[model samples]
Target: MNETVNQPTYKRQRFLLSFVHQINGSVSVTDLQKLVFLHMMSEDSNYYEFIPCKYGPYSFQLKEDLDILQRGGFVTLDYVQGSERIKATGDFPTGYFFRIPTERGKALMRRAYREYPYYSINSEITDRFFQGEELEQFNRGKQTYAQTEQVLFTIGYEGKSIEAFINTLIQNNVRLLCDVRKNPISRKFGFSKGKLKHIAQTVGIRYVHIPDLGIDSDKRRSLATLDDYKHLFEDYEKTLPSKKRFLDEILMLLQQNTRIALMCFELESNMCHRHVIRDYLVRTNQVRSVDI
Candidate 1:
């Protein structure tokens, strides 16, 4: 939990590098991703979560973690057969691989595709990894999860890895994400604007950030009690009229897209300003908002 020259600042980052260490040899980035994806399934920790991607189960947050570890000199990476390769290096924390040994050799990747067909839905190489009956089975799993229901939603990423957060979005078939953060920046890996937008686009979800709909940072500083949050959001409600155009724009998005979620930093909808916006939309348009 503490920052250091030899340690990854977050548990998730450590676990990621631990997988690289488990390999004991350089692993292709693609294979490392599949390995970690498979590992996350076996481990109960929400330290890392994943979304189905072009290369099967992928975690944008994990990618960011590797980048950070690289910058910190705890890992090494290079191009391998047109894909990036990863390996543990000097000062990398050793013996931290958490999960009991699962599968090894070729079975790991095969198991990843075979067992988790949903994750391999959009996989660019599913065909190569599986064939015949297996290929057909994989095909059956490729159905898109996006839905056509008119709903407003609120989701907070307080304790979730970005991968877990996006996984939730993909699972709920959320078509658009309305970010109600005033600054659209974060210490969290993928929630920051640029990274968040990239992840959204990768998963075919739209991202919209409306600073006007957010509670300013200065006012968010020392909320030590429920009464504090009450006053903070109460003041947030008063600013809605001045932010009417932004509210209408979000409403239009939900109207047009059918499934839109308001995103913010708190895990509980009650603790985030996005809930206030959700209330406003629901009261005005008679559309209910679900907390995700």
Candidate 2:
């Protein structure tokens, strides 16, 4: 039985929709955690505990939850070779894949948005998502300031193609790449601070490594307790003011002409501290994240 069945209908809807969106292709567990959290935040700004998945103790029952979504026909899971090579043959090798709802999912979401109008999250001006000229101005001018505008926003990273993902930001001419990894050196590509810095520089993007944005393992341990995990999570929430200060110090370095992206190992923002930082920026600086 799907334990998520007992969760409020909106919570389930938010989780499944975000999960399906992230799994449109291959995705790592870390990526899923981030995506789910972002969705929850968009639905409700105060919502910050993670979905019940393997990333953390509270979200450890991933198999069961995924099973529920699978049974509902909301998603399909398969293990493939993990990569694909395309050619004129038109036949591709088998690889890991998570087939997610396309048009049908969007249609359902539209209906849900109507039926559960109260389920919609209304973030304060500081929590609004960024779009259009606001984003353009932020990236184009140095130190140019805009009053904070509250707009609904969500962070999503896991998707079909990595090159496609990178291209989105490049096409937008995003200028700065903020490396929020504590170590800045990873065993993987696109994460190690050095490699990412070089790549972003080559693409005309400035890369800045901010150790403060890295998840504090000690702090995380403090957040996990036997008694439901909510207490510790809330404790972490209280520290945001300091975190915001640190992030602002970093942002202050931007010369009004910079567009910044906080990068970490997790593909989704929710699973990582970057989302919290993103929230702080939106609420405090009027800066918002767009899907790029």
Each prediction's RMSD over C-alphas, in Å, is 3.7, 16.0
Instruction: Show how many residue pairs clash in every candidate, following the order shown.
Output: 0, 19
List, residue by residue over 1-292, the lDDT tens digit for candidate 1. 2245767878778777776776767877767777777666776556667888887788777787888988887778898668687878854556674553456535666788777878876677777667798788778666566467788889998988787888788878888998988899889778899889989888788998887777778888898899999998898899889889998999889889889899999999998888888898889889967899
Model 1 worst lDDT run, 10 consecutive residues = 97-106
Q: For each candidate, what TM-score against the reference?
A: 0.84, 0.40
Model 1: colliding residue pairs: none
The 10 consecutive residues of candidate 2 with the worst lDDT sum are 84-93
The global Cα lDDT (0 to 1) of model 1 is 0.80
Instruction: Give the TM-score (vs. native) of candidate 2.
Output: 0.40
Best by TM-score: 1
